[model samples]
Each structure stands twice: as structure tokens, then as C-alpha cells.
Target: MAEYIMAEKNNRMIPEEDKIFALNARAKKMSEEVGRDKVINATIGSLLDDDGKLVMLLSVVKALKGLEPLDFAEYAPIGGTTDFKKAVKKAAFGKHRSSSFVEVVATPGGTGALRNIVANYSKIGDRVLTSDWFWGPYKTITGELYRELCLYPMFDENNRFNKKGFSEELNKLAADQESVLILLNTPSHNPTGYSLDGDDWNGISEAVKEASKKARITLFVDAAYIDFAGDEEEYRTFLPKLEDMPSNVLPVIGYSFSKTFTLYGMRCGAMIAMAPSEEIAAEFKLVNEFSARGTWSNSTRSGQVLVSKVYEDEDLLESVNKERAGYREMLIKRGKAFSNSVIEAGLPLVPFDSGFFSCIPLKDPAAVSKRLEEKGIFVVPLAKGIRVSVASISEEICRKLPGMIAEVIE
Candidate 1:
């Protein structure tokens, strides 16, 4: 009698749930359902506007302006270039420093910095808080690190910040008095497209201060779309105030060059940690350096150098503004078209001001998404809603959304 059993190898014998596989499977199902043509592809995070591209145009062609290209072929320091850091600090914080310490570490992009920051700072059981309508990756990244996410509802029907719910949640975290982590992606909320305005922004920031008084909560501001938010002058008014951030509360910013510069493939980002104590800032730098070294070693030197030039050249901002303005116009146009069509088609939608995406309500989002695809349209089906990216969708294709949606509803 021979006994046959499959032997398990260490680390090799893990369960293969493979959520990525499930995600792809769902995508395949979507493509099959939607059919070939009439596909109003409202999916992805890349540029839809062709005008703003000229902002980084000079840097691209002027690669031969001064230093050799190979000069950028080497590895940058783990902490990034002094010039780049200075420029980014200026871009993000403007001018004001009550920080005990302040410094920047170049990351692969927001994801890289977020990875390093979480690895360096958040412990296994740390309770991380963020808006319910947040970037999906935050959950995956933090969850992979075995951290718990506490979500506060983001908006109401008026499409305003849910300050009451936000305060209640923060107070709950404070009552526990544990190391609470708060992630804020304001200026323009994604998926919802709602940015804080008027007294609301002040109120929310004040509430954050209140939460800080109660417990050691790290306020991580995920400002990936800072460059894209409407009215740069209006939005930037609060950044300079970060210089006044407290020591008990470390206000770390996750910055990105992905959207602003349209260098999605460049994979460039930075983490600017502003601690009240310079001594604390120094420690963060050292730890951050260690974390960077352990992970990516260093960022691409060419990108670091190129971004530096754009920063130093004040003339570059004029081009950026021109480009940004054009992109803003396109976004507004596309968003209006979709909203109007959605209204005509009688589909309820998530409220938005400006940013990447918009959404509509649907039960069993995946199933509904499949039905819409049969009509030649694709969308991202979230748990509570479906996401649409206006940029990737064409005007002709955009016009057809209402009809297709009507078909699905019928």
C-alpha cells in the first residue's frame, strides 16, 4: 500500500488566490460582453489633452541643451538631487518653515514613496484612515503591509465634504489614542471629482489639527493631482501653511510627476516629509534613505536631471500654465458632455468638480458593466459605482454613451 501525497515547499506552497487573475478575468468578461465597435472607452489615467504636452516639450528636445544624455544614465542618490528637491519643496510648500525638519526623497512615483513611507513608518497593526472614495492602490498597498483601513464617507448629494462624518471618525480614532494614520487626497477628489471649497477646506484642516491634539496621527497628503487641480493660485494658498505643520503631527506629502508633466512612463515621484523638529526630519531622512536603498536603490538620473531643469527655469512655468489651461478646457468640455448625456439618459451620477473620473450607480457593478459592454462601451466597475475617464474617451464615442446606457437600462 503506497501513500501518495503532494509535498509542500516552504514559501512555495502558498495559497494562490490571485486577485489580479480575478481582475483580469473580469476584464475579459467585459470585453466579450461589450462587442467590438461603439466602445466608449472611458478607462485609464493617462492624458486626453494634446495641448499641455508642450509644457515639457522644451525639456524633451533640449536634452542636448547642456549636459550629455549619458550623464543621466547613472544612478541618482537615494534621496534625489539637491536641486530637484529644492524645486519640489518650493513647488509644494512655497515658502514658510516652522518645521523642526523638512526634506524630500525622490521615489519612483507616488507609489514608490508611498511604499517606502508605509514600510518605514506604519507598523503591522496601525489603523490607517482615508476617504471611502480613494485610490484603490492605497488599500492594496496598506493591506499588503497588513495594515487596517478605516474609511470615512467622502461626500453627500450636494457634493460637498462630509465634515460631520469626517470629524466623528477622527474623534473615534482619537478616543482610542493609538497611532492613527490619515490619508487626504484633497484639492480635487478622484472618482467623485469634488474638491473642498470656501469654509469647508478650513474646517477640514482644522478638524485634522483637532485629531492631532488627541493622538499621534500621521497626516499623509496624497497630492498626486496638485498640478491638475483647478485655479492653481486658489489651491496653492494652503500649501505654504504646511510650513507651520506641527512636530507631534508629521505632514508627509506624496508628490508625483506623472500627470503634471505627462511623464507617466518616467516613473518619477518624491516624498516630502515635514516634521516639526529638524532633528526629527533628520531621522526621517536617514530612515527614508535606508528604505529607498533597500527598495529601488536610486531613481533614474535622467528624469531627476530633466525635472530639475524644468524647476530652475522659471520661463518653463509659462509653458506649463498655457498647457495646463488648455487641458483644463478639454476636461471641462468632456465632463459636461458626459454629464448632460447621463442626465438625458436618466442615469444617476456621482458629483464631481474636476479630476480624472466620474461615476454612475449600479447594483452588481461587474454584471451591469458587462451589459453596457454589449453596447460597445467600457467602464471601471467599483463596488459602489462605475468609473468613467473622460480623457481617453473620444467626442464621437462620448456622444453615444447616452444611447448605449439607455439600451442597458432597457
Candidate 2:
């Protein structure tokens, strides 16, 4: 009798738990043991009010409640409703009209969109490229799909985007692989909260255009936190640059409503492609839809309906934006408070612009995180740093955390 009775491929897959959620559970247990007010739970990625309650947009909630039973109960189309697709395009592109052919495919969330991209775009055992400082799930997704995740140093000595390093790695990858999938998470990136500016985007575009001469390049933009980044129109200025890429280079946007609409559990999002040709656009839709059918067949109808309704009605859209803006401001305040405190405490943090989470880069992240946990401060320790969720903590906690972390580090 063998100690293990699983397939060869499944043999290496060990039962592992998500570090963030595991820490969150421990935080909740501590909250119950010692009063909730005494513990600072910065492990969760979701936005929480100053009162430590999860924040949900009332307008979005009302819109969902107003939906007819059939609207939610009925199964959505394999791809998505036509109206929903249109709404997603409008939401993603904003005022930037592209000359290239575009297509959209509904996904469970941004994660599903990423999965489809990895499944359809890259071959097995191929390398998927991204920044070294990335969302941990990127590795998990690629590993599960029988692909490898590769990295480029995210920043330079000046703490700016490392365009040179990116181009170097991209060229290196293109030399070996015929097709390359590059995942760029920006406009409020996870953990680090770093957003690439226009200069950064320009550098990226130039690099991609140059690399496309040799290999087929799929530029995947994970824009999950775009809505919370900053000025709505200003943050989206980089989108138009993706329009004029070479025929071999495809720009795909992964849009998620989980953060924007606060519908995390609903798992609603879309994978949008800006193709240089009609044939490419058609193939993008067909391949992703086929992958969706094989995986999670249909998305949440209610969530799609909610987004469609919000975009379809001008007033509803305005209301939803207004409500969401308030929460965005709250998040900004919390982030600012934490940043300011870190500065005052002489604590070094990763380049943080605007987002739910920021990271403090230090050696022995796990050990430091354990020390923080002993003090009833729960945070997710990453490979290079500990992630502090400013969105989940109050402004007061945000102000206090830096000093506490600094003390622990010292």
C-alpha cells in the first residue's frame, strides 16, 4: 500500500492554506478573545468602515435588490449578456475610444479572466512574465495551469519603474518562447499599491512594441483596483496607448467588480481585448468563451445585471459613482494616514501611491509578522515584506500601526 494514492501531476500539489485568510481568522479569534476594539486586523483586503464593519455601496445594494427574480435566477449566456459586455467595455475603456478591434468575455472575476488568458494564450510549461512584487495568486494560477511565472525587478535604485529591467527580461523571454503573456497590475497594484504613471506606461508600450517584432505578446493588465486609484478620468489616460500596438501584440484588460462595486462574493468581471485586427478580436472572444465553458460555465447573472443597469441608466451610474467615491476617499484617507505615520516613524515602505494595501519591505517578514501577531496586530507576510491593509483598518489604527511596526522591527 502506497502512502499517497494520487496522480503524478497531483502528487506535488500539497494542501496549502491562503496566508491572508488564515491570519484574518486568527485576528477574528483574537477579536473575540480580547475585545474587537483592542485588536488591529489588517489582514483582510476588503474595505471596512471606521467602525470595523465591511463597507458596501448602498446604491449598488439597492440596485441588486431591485432586480427581478428572473434577472438573477436565470442563467446568463455562456459569454455574457450583450448589454453586460457593452457595459464592461464602457466601464473599462471609459472615454478612450480605440481604433483596434475590441472584444469582451464575462468571467467569474479578474481571477477567471487571468485563468482563461493563461489557458488560451500560453503553452504548457511556458513562462508567464510579471513584476517581482506581484499578487501571490499570480504564481498559484500559473502553477495550477502547468505554467511557470517569471519575474522582472519592479523598481530601480531610484524607486521608479525599472523599464530597462522589464525590457531586458521581456526580450529574454521572447527569445525562447513564441508566445509571451505579460501580467501588469497597476493603477493601484496589490500589496505595494504602486501605480505606474504616463512615463511608465510609455516605457512599457515601447518595450512591448519592440518585443512584438519577434514573438506574439499578450499584455494582460489587471485593473482590479482602478476605481479606487484616484481621479476617475486621470487614472485611465494610459488605456488609449494600448490601441496602436502591433498585430502580434494584444492588450487585454481584466476588469473586476469585486472592488469597484464591493461585490467580492458575487465574482463578477470581464476579460477585454483590444486586438489589432478583426480576426484576432474574434479569436480572443471564441477562445476565452470556450475556456469559460470548460471552467466556470456561467457568471453571476445578478452582478452582471447590476453593472448593466448602473451603466445603462445615467442617473443610476451617477449615484453609484457618487456612493463609491465616498468610500474611495475613506480609503485614501486611511492610506495617507498610514503613509504619514510611516514617514514620521522613519519606517521604510514600498512605493505606495493609492490603494487598499501597502507593504513594508524588510528581512525576515515572517518573523516580524509573528511578532506583530503577538501584539494583536495581524497582517499578511509576503515573500519580501508584510502587507498592511489600510482599507480594513480605521484611520486611527492606520496612524498607530507604523509606529508599532517600527517598534517591533527595531
Candidate 3:
């Protein structure tokens, strides 16, 4: 008599598109009707040029095009090639010694890395901790793994990192959970554009070290937008802070070439485990490889080869960095222009420092987003705010956005 049969876990599944993609569709339709230049489409996270074209790095395109058919056809190692493992660690830690005991596993992208972490790190029915305002996928990933994502306040009254709230949450999780997985997305955080300062990192590490007395603490740093945030080495200075955490606390980093190399569709990334002991590091490698085998089996060999070649070849590396720098500047300019315009318009935003998007707290995000769409401006509506993708819109559009949002919000 049943209309359909499914597992209890699959009962909550709904066929639905993400809010950003839905708004992106509406933006495209509006653009077709009113002309692209007249419509500000800041619905997606990808970088776009002043001319409103999707920005693809010539370096990445050349690398992919240069690959042989065999390279594309072959299967990569389940955990990725040796060269890719080295390259990812180099990219993430730079000259930092925090990666001394780090082991790398190739993933489809940062999303895959996060999936492995949520699957292997947190116990079933346990809760993972992150900021209240976070990337929605974190919740979805945890839910699918039969775990939950808990939130701690992200900012204080002064709009600084809420160290006190974070410490409280860590203590609470340690008291109840056998293992706690903490996700910190920074150096250009999603939707909010908030990056943690060195002091903030120190406080977080200290808190985690203290919490490790009772529970296994795994700090998962999702640095998906690091390249666009600031000077690469400067942003990585916080890695050493994590290095000083107690042996019971493991620090894993998620690195993606999606934003960095403009290899979004290529889906190349790595999960790095910083284990205090050699035995632990080796075990991490084995288990993560097993996870990869059970999941995608292997990632794209061409993508892995591309990453290795770019890192190993000085000339190609220079070209890649140059292209990235150009886009990074464009993003910075757009962000600054938008921030200035917001201040000028007296529009309150979540203290944005650097990133592709900025969020404005709204009483009714869905309704406000609808109103903006009616005005030919499309943005993604979040639980508590409207996210404007400055990376996808031009500086000119960025300059005009705040006033429009202010008009709608006020």
C-alpha cells in the first residue's frame, strides 16, 4: 500500500535547488529581458569580469588543454598522487612548520574533504560545531552523515571574533561528546567575508588545547577562499598557532583549487591531517584513502597532474600566480567599493573584511530578496541575511548595490 519505499534516513530528502542557484536562474531571466548591464546579478559565488563574463584563469585553461588524453583517462591514486600531496601542503602552509606531520588525501574538492572529515572524524548522532552564520552545505553534510551541526555566536558586541562564546561551546561539546569536530571557515569566509585575525587563532587554539583534556578535538579549517582574501603567506601565519595545540587535538585543513586556480569544474582539492605522531599520520593516510576508495574511488588524474605541474614548474607557477593576483585585486576593489558604499548609505552589514560575498542582516531575508529581484537586482537569501556576491559583480555595480539594498531594507 506504500506509494514508495525508502530508508528512514532518506525520508527527509527533498528535490530542491539551492537558494543561490534559484536566484541565479531568476537573474538570468531578468538579464535576458532587461539586458545584462541593467541587471545586477550577484547570485553566484564565482568571479566575474567588469564585462559580466565568467572569469576563467588562462593558466588553468592552458594547463588543462595541454594534458594528454591518457592523463584525462587514467585513474589517480585513491588518496591522490605523491606530487599533489606535496603541492597542496606547500600551497596551504607555505613556509610554516605546522605541517611537519601532515598527511594529505586527494579529494574531489574541499566539499569532498569536508565529507570525509564529517564521516570519519565525528561519531554518529554527535554534533559538529561552527559559527551560527555558516555555509549551508555544512549542515547538509552533517545531516547526511547522521550527525548534527551546532552553532556558536560568531561575533561579539564589538564585531570581533566571539572567543568567549567559542570557548563555552567547546566546553559544552567536550563534556558530552566523545569526539568534537570544529569547522572554522576563514581567510575569506563564505557569505559573511569575515577573516580571523592572528589573535583570534591563538585564542581558538588555546581553547581547543584546554578542551582536549576531556575529548578528542578536531579543528577543521576550510580555507576555500584563501587566495582571494589577502597576501597568501600573511593569511597562513595562523597555521603555526594551531601547531601548538595538544596532541589530543588534530588540525585538518581543507584546500580547494576551485577558487585559487579557477579550476572549479575540475574539482581538485585535498584534505590535510596534521597529526602529532607519525603513527597517527600514517593511520590517517590509510583511513582517508579507504574513505576515498569507498566513495569516488579516485579523483580526476588530469586535475591532479595539473596541480603538480603548476607547482613544480617555476614559469607556469609564475603565470598562475600572476593571473590569480589580477583577479584578487579585482575582488578587493569590488569589496572595498561595496563596503564604502554601504557605509555611505548607512547600511549595516556583518563586519566584512575580505571575501567574494558580504551579508546584510535582514528581518525577512526571503521577502527582501524578492523585493530586490523585482528591482532587477538578484542576491541569495540566507536564514538571517541577504548575501551579495561582490566577486561576481563589477565594482560599478558594487558601488550602486548598497544604496539599492538600503532602500529595500529600510
- Best-fitting candidate, measured by TM-score? 2
- Model 1 — which ten-residue stretch has the worst lDDT? 49-58
lDDT for each residue of candidate 2 in 2-73, tens digit (9 for 90 to 100): 345564553135445667778889999999999997799998888999888899999899999999999979
Q: Rank the candidates by TM-score, best first.
A: 2, 3, 1
Task: Name the runs in model 3 displaced over 4 angstroms.
Answer: 1-15
Which pairs of residues clash in candidate 2, taking residues 3 or more apart in a chain or in different chains?
none
Query: How do all models score by TM-score?
Result: 0.84, 0.97, 0.97
lDDT of 1 by residue, 1-410 (tens): 13325753321323355433454355446556764342455665665543212233444435425656675677788899888798778766544443346779999988887787777766786767888877777777777677767898886667667887788898788777466777887665666666667566576677777887778767777878776767666766665455554457787888887776676778888998878777868877899889888878888776677777777777775666566667766666776787778788888877666677777767777887778655556677787877777766655555567667767767
- Provide the global lDDT of candidate 2 against the true structure: 0.91
For lDDT, candidate 1 versus 3, the one ahead is 3
Model 3: pairs clashing at backbone N, Cα or C within 3 Å: none
The number of residue pairs in model 2 that clash at the backbone is: 0
Q: Which wins on lDDT, candidate 2 or candidate 3? A: 2
lDDT of 3 by residue, 1-410 (tens): 22345535442343356667787888898889889877988878889888877899998799889988988998888999999888998888877876448899999999999999998999889999999999988988898888888899999898889999999999899999988999999988997999999889878987898889999998999999998898988988888777787888888999999999888898899999888888878988898889889888898888899999899998998899888998899899999999899889997789898989998887899999999889998988888888999988989889999998899887
